[model samples]
Target: MVKRTALYVTLVAGAFVSVFPYLLVALTALKTPRQLSGTEPWEPGLPPTFANLDRVMHSGFAGYLGNTLLMTAALTAGQLVFTTFAAYAFARLRFRGRDVLFWLYVATMMVPSAVTMIPLFLIMRELHLVNTWWGLLAPYLLGTPYGIFLMRQFFRALPAGLEDAARIDGAGPLTILLRIVLPLSRPALGTLAIITVISSWNNFMWPLIITSGDDTRVVTVGIAGLKGSIGVDPNQMTAAALIALVPMVAVFVAFQRYIVRSVVLTGLK
Candidate 1:
């Protein structure tokens, strides 16, 4: 009983640590600027107001939200399609130097984006993709090395009997991949999709470098601008931040079961 009590206490403490920041941010969003800037950070008194949220929305938050959603959805879909195909080939298909090529791909992950930022920017400039949504979406769509690696690991863990049986029944590689492997790999793919969406939605550095105008500015970058323009308006900033978190939170909550299972499988493998 003591051990169980200790374990429960630890778990509850951990949960509180994870959730407390979000709770603070949520409540701050409801506060007025005066309350937020005052000495006491935790005191509660007045009724919550939506004026901050209203101000954020009127200040082009809607446009930023739309741009972020579009980019995130596009990047996630592209990663899912491209990573799954590449992972399947690496896992099931025999080819010359496949392991070498896969290792090289993984090696790129070790190379920080900062190292290649200049080159990537110059390439985008040459391609006339800078300051556009295509600029934001292009790098991610080509199949991220990490996404490929994760999918490959998941694919490798799948039973080979399914593929062999499909091949004996006159199924081509493409047919088998589509009809067999993909359906069984939904959990991993869903997890990857969720991860991809969140990463793309929250990406700041690349978007800041590539985009400038209102036409392509995403939520994170937009929030930075909001900060500069609002200048210490904590309530407004908090409201915008809270709003920015909504889509990713909704996606995670909706697919949480699959995400948990995928994480467990990935770790076990």
Candidate 2:
């Protein structure tokens, strides 16, 4: 009884700690400047204001949101396709040097993104992809080492007996992969899609450096631009942040079961 009570207390405390900042941001977004500057600044107003939201909607944030949505959708779809195939090949195919090659690719995951940022930027510049939609999507649309590794892990966890049975019935590799393996991988696929969407949606540094203007700016970069030369408005900045946060929350709510299933099933087989 005592241990269970302690566990519940700890969980409640952790949830509060995690949610407090977002709750503060929500309250700030609803406040007017006077309310924001008041002694009870964090308190919710009697009737929350929408001025910050209205301002943000008119301030090119809508365009940024659109760009983020498009980029995230494309990036997620492309990653799912590429990673599925690559991971399947790695997990099932018996090509020579396959293990060696997979390990070599996975090894690249150890290197931080910061270390490769400049090199990637230069390559984009050389290809004249900078400041274009292609530049925005090119780097990640092909998928990541991490994505391939993740899908491979889940693929390897699948029962081999089913695949062997399919093969005995004269099913080719592609046919077996499409008809048998993929249907069983819904949880892993959903988890990867959500991860890719969230990652692409919140990507900042690559989008910031690769694109020079608002034409290609995503939500994260747009939110950063909400700052003013003189000072930042607590209400407007928080409002923009809240707007950016909504889609991610919705995604988690929708696919949360897949995430839970993947965590439970992966890395054991």
Candidate 3:
């Protein structure tokens, strides 16, 4: 009883800690410019208003949001399709030097993104891909090592009996993968999709560098522009930040079950 009570207390405390900053941001977004600029940053001074949201939306935020959504959706889909196939091949198929190839792919993950930034930029420039959505998504759409690794782990956990049974029934490799493995691996796939969307949506550095104009600007870079334009308008910035967070929060809520299942499965093996 004591242990259970202590565990509950810890969980509640952790939840509070996680939620407090968002609460502060919510309160600040509701404040007037004057209230936000005043000395007490924590104190709620007025009733919530939608003025800040209105201001942000009017300031080209709609375009940015659209661009972000498109980029995230495309990147997530591309990552899942490519990574799933690659992971399935690595996990199930026998090939020449397969282990060596997979290890080499995993080794690439050890190299930090910063190390490859200049080379990637040069390649993009050469291909005239800079300042385009293609440029922004090029690196991610190629299938991330981490995504491949995670999918491979999940696929490895699956029973080979299903694949064997499908083969005995004259199902081809692609048929088995599509009808059997993918259907059973929905939880892992959902988790990957969520992670990919979140990462691509919130991507800042690469997009900031690659996309030079309004035609390709994503939300994170657009938010930075908003910060620069508004300068000291904390209310506006807070509202914009909240707007940026909504989609990801909605996604998490929608896929909460799959996300939990994925984590539990991953932990088990």
Candidate 4:
């Protein structure tokens, strides 16, 4: 009984430690300037203020949020299409040099994106895609090495009897994939969607380097600009950051079970 109590205490303590910073930020974002300057760091304002949220919403943060949403959706759709097809082929289709090709493709995952960033930029510049939406999306839209590897593993682990039965029913490869494989792989797909959304939404460096115009600027870079630009207050900055964090939090809340289930099914630590 004592050990169980201690374990619950530890878990509660750890959760509080993890959540305390965000709680502070929320408090700060809602406090009036006078209250914020005068009060203890952890103290809540006598009454909360919405002026920070109003200011941030008016400062073109909405545009950045829209851009991020569009980019995330496009990247997620493209990733699902390419990753699903490629993973299915690698797992099910018998082709010459298949193993060799898959391993060679997987080897690219070891090569850090920073190493290739400059070369990729130069190619984009040569093609006159710099400062364009296409430039931002083109590099990642095809799918990622990690995404391919994850889906491929899940596909390979599926029951072969299902595929064999489908084949006997005159189902072509596409039919089998669409009707049997994909429907059964919903958990893995949901996991990939969450991963793609989080990565694309949080990506800052690549978007900052690739595009300079506000027209294509993402929320991550926009949040950084809130910090550096003249006359932007800390409360507003915190508010903008909190706004950006809400969607991701919502996504995880909705699909968290899929992520846990996929991890268990894929045997990933």
Q: In TM-score terms, which candidate is top?
A: 2
Q: Per-residue CA lDDT of candidate 2, range 1-269, in tens?
A: 99999999999999999998988989999888888877375589657899999999899999999999999999999999988999999999999999999999999989999899999999999999999999899989987898898889988888999999999999999999999999998878988998888889889999999987888899899888888999888889999999999889898888888667656654564
Candidate 4: tens digits of C-alpha lDDT, residues 191-247:
998889889999988898899988999999998888754686778788888889888
- Residue 108 in model 4: shift from native, Å? 2.6
Model 1 weakest lDDT span, ten residues long? 36-45
- Worst 10-residue stretch by lDDT in candidate 3? 225-234
Candidate 1 per-residue lDDT over residues 1-269, each given as its tens digit: 99999999999999999988878778888888777766366665277778888989999989999998888889988999999999888888999999999999889999998898889899999999999878878888979888888888888998999888988999999999999989998888888887887789889999999999998999999888865643666777788999998777898778778767666765787
Top lDDT hit: 4
Clashing pairs in 3: none
Residue pairs clashing in model 1 are none
Rank all candidate structures by their TM-score, best first, as comma-separated numbers: 2, 4, 1, 3
| Each prediction's TM-score versus the true structure | 0.92, 0.95, 0.91, 0.93
Cα lDDT of model 3 by residue, 11-48, tens digit = 99999999888888888888887777773767885776
Q: Could you tell me how far off, in angstroms, the CA of residue 267 lies in candidate 3 after the best superposition?
A: 3.8
lDDT of each: 0.86, 0.89, 0.87, 0.90
Better of 3 and 4 by TM-score: 4
Mark the regions of model 2 whose C-alpha exceeds 4 Å error after superposition. Answer: none
Q: Answer with 2 or 4, whichever has the higher TM-score.
A: 2
